[model samples]
Target: MIPAHEKSETHSKIDPDLNSKGVDEEGETTDHNLTYYQQMQEASLEQLAEHRALLQIFNLHQAGRIEEKWKENESLVVWLGMQIAILKRDFTEYSNCPAHEYNGENRETDEFDEEKELNELHKKVLELTKLRLLELGMFDDFPSKFELVETSRPSKNTINKRFNKLLRKIPSELFPSIRELKFKNYIQSILDGIKKITIGHKIYYNQVTADLEEKGKLKFDYLFQTIEFLLRDHFISENDLKTLFQEDHILRIFSIYFFHSSQQGFSSMVKQLTPSFITDQCFWKFGFSFSQVLDEKDKVRMNFELLIAHLFFNGNRLRGFQEWDSFEKSFGRKKYLDHLKNPDRLKLSTSLQVEGKEEVPPLSLIGTDQEFSGDVNNLVKLFLATLNGPKKTRALSGLVCELLDFINSNISPGILDRSFKKLGSSKNLRLQFDLILIPTRINYSMAVAMEFHDIAERNGLSLAPKVMESIFISYQDRVISLNKELIKVYSQFKNRYGSLSSWLKQNPEYSKINEKSLNQWLKAMSIIIEECATEAKELDRRIQAAHGTAH
Candidate 1:
């Protein structure tokens, strides 16, 4: 009887057909094939019922719910073993069939060494059952049916024994080696027959060896086949191959292979290969290359491509390498030209004049793509211009450094400051300082102050009465103006003093003004500023005292 599962599988594969009998002239009554069909139907139903019962028993055993008495049920074991053998046979038959064409007939028949075939099939079933039992941790009890098969057909056992001996002789690992040797010989035979496959065309074999050596041994044939498939599929072009090989660097080759393989699999090869790699030195080279390339469109394309490549590779636009690459690719060459063509790009002005130094006005800043031709003359003109401008209008020490950076120069802060100071007076420049210039100048001032403080402290001059007084006063004034609470606190102090000048006589606790207490002072002063009145006058007094000036 057909099992329920097998019946379902068969039903899914078959379609019902209509059967007809002789019809009367009026088409009202006719003899039908109902009796024959009913018999077939009854047989099918009985088969299905038997199959269902077998399935129930199999499921019970599978789920470990079968009773101990039923564990050794020979009938159930035999049925299951037969089902497994049939499944394997059917699977092999279907696998071997040509998918594009079919002939209507069972491929296997009983006449062809049926016992040997059945024995072999039974062995496969036993192997699978053993594997299952192993997985279930029930390896001790192999079914007796497997052992009884040989005795049941003693003559057949001799052939089965020989086959089993041959199977035992074959090592699983050697199968692949044999397959490879056969494939190689087949290809060699083809070449020998064709007489066209020369050693020169065997470049791929060498490449495969080298790749294996470098990347660790892998399936060369598989990789080669994949590359061939990629080429055939138009996922990668000849240009890409040429470019990747032309580089010849091992790392670059590795990168290209990785990129190409991944992209081929996903069709993103073009995106992967479009970008050029970047490094610190690459920026300078790229800049130089951009300058060498004359056409604007070519320059833009090259620069933009480099920029995009840098961005893609680094995964950031503002990183150190990325920014450098972008800047050099974008404006390095163009700026060089502007330095030559436009005087404004190099302009400078200062108010203070020194002996033998000519006064100059500030040069106009050049825009991104403007042309300039003055070159050295523009630089000289800018220096002179910056010297002649108001002291505040002169470039700050940091600005000078940045300008040097733009020109790829290396002028020290002291030299730059001295150069500017020689040309312009500090007071005149101070009046012209804008917020843009203020931060730069303030930073420079703070830097200079820190340097001076460091040098003085190192030499024991920082603690001098005058220096200490000046620093204290300056810090106090800053604390008051910078923080409203400090101003308010100073106001309260002034109210207690009954006059601003009297409050100035009170010395601040300088020992408490160390770095550790600076933040505390700031907080305390914030409260004072917020709560105090007449704060500005008190602040002025403190500044005068600190500066060694009397109000």
Candidate 2:
């Protein structure tokens, strides 16, 4: 048996041609024969046509129409020039054809071949005309239409032969200057103007922006005219056109134009040219241009506000709305009531601690005192600044937590309860909070606990008694010591009374209190109050906790 590599080589060397006839298996000989046959056929046809035309030219020379020969020759030259121009135009159009063809195949055939052949014939006619003109000594003097033709004209074929020869030596003068002049005067001139206008517009916008910024006041008329010119003449789309008007310094130019145009009853034109919706679309769709108008900071804020508003407006239609409801439901009714009652829990403090500035006053004082309102506004601004301008999840969550805390601390329980019911009816605040918070599973527990505390504290109540009872029952192991002490106290207090049942009948509020229930309620209240402390205490604890070592 052969080795594997040697066997593969042996198979590879076994040529198919070895089993075939004398023909090379590569097919080179057949391909060469086919190509040679085609070339020979083309050459034969060209030779035949040349010979026939020569004989015809000889015959035409025997006839007499010599005087009209020059006109014929000139006509042939004109026809050839026209054909060339048409070919050039067709070539250009084909070259720039759009990418609509499947698989990138060429679709057009050489349908202009007949016209090209006629062009060749005309070239020959021109050569005959030119030589005849030279022989008549009219080449030196400007030949009139009649002088170039022979009185005894050659046969048509002879004339055709002479024209073909003339075409081979097509002189710059053989082609009439008028045709060239017309092309340069008409087509070229228009193309040049288009090029100039494009170049000019680019330069003009750059210079105009620079000049306007330098002058500090842009001329409204010039700006408007420039914009219109760009749109109409340059094929500039609405987006690019708007960009020219977007530069802060340049756009100011339009402010005056806008006002003047509106005053002159050109409001419709202005609307058509620069609609607000279009402007907003341009800003949003093309962020760079939008940034140019509002600056990056304001643009971000604007977008964030718009996003929030859009989400709020479409909350019911959003899939996430159900999840938002689920989150609110998780916090329970009592928690939401607490949020409404306590404004302290809801009012987020500014993360920026401005030194030497008095603490922000109460909202009630905002209406009564101008300075107080100003301070509050400033504080609100500062808090808003802490929102990280826009679309900042961390900042938003912090703000939501602060607001809930503020409401929990400040708002009355009755008002908070009403607000909770309203929240349930409207459900808009849930959406608003969700837009800002973007709840995560990791932060879910914290958010729920914070909300629960804020709502309960604001409502001037504890967590639902049943909830406390449930927690105590579920986590009895964790609270067993506290429960035992509470049981001892309850037993002693009950012994001082008739019995556990009698004590409960005496005071319904405490009647059902077990050792575990008492402990859990106290623990739940402590958790709620601890989480609802003032900013100062919260900050201090956070700082110490950060430094504190775990035992």
Query: Number of clashing residue pairs in every model?
Result: 46, 55
- lDDT for 110 in candidate 2 is 29
Q: Cα deviation in Å at residue 105, candidate 1?
A: 72
Residues 447-510 of candidate 1: C-alpha lDDT, one tens digit per residue: 3323333333343221223423454344345444434433333454444434333323341210
What's the TM-score of each model vs. the native? 0.15, 0.16
lDDT of 2 by residue, 52-107 (tens): 23223333542234324433343222322322332233333433333223244453
Q: Name the runs in model 1 displaced over 4 angstroms.
A: 1-317, 320-325, 333-369, 372-437, 460-551
- Candidate 1 at 92: error in angstroms? 82
Q: Which stretches of candidate 2 lie over 4 Å from their true place?
A: 1-287, 318-551
How big is the positional error of residue 232 in model 2, measured in Å on the Cα after superposition?
A: 16
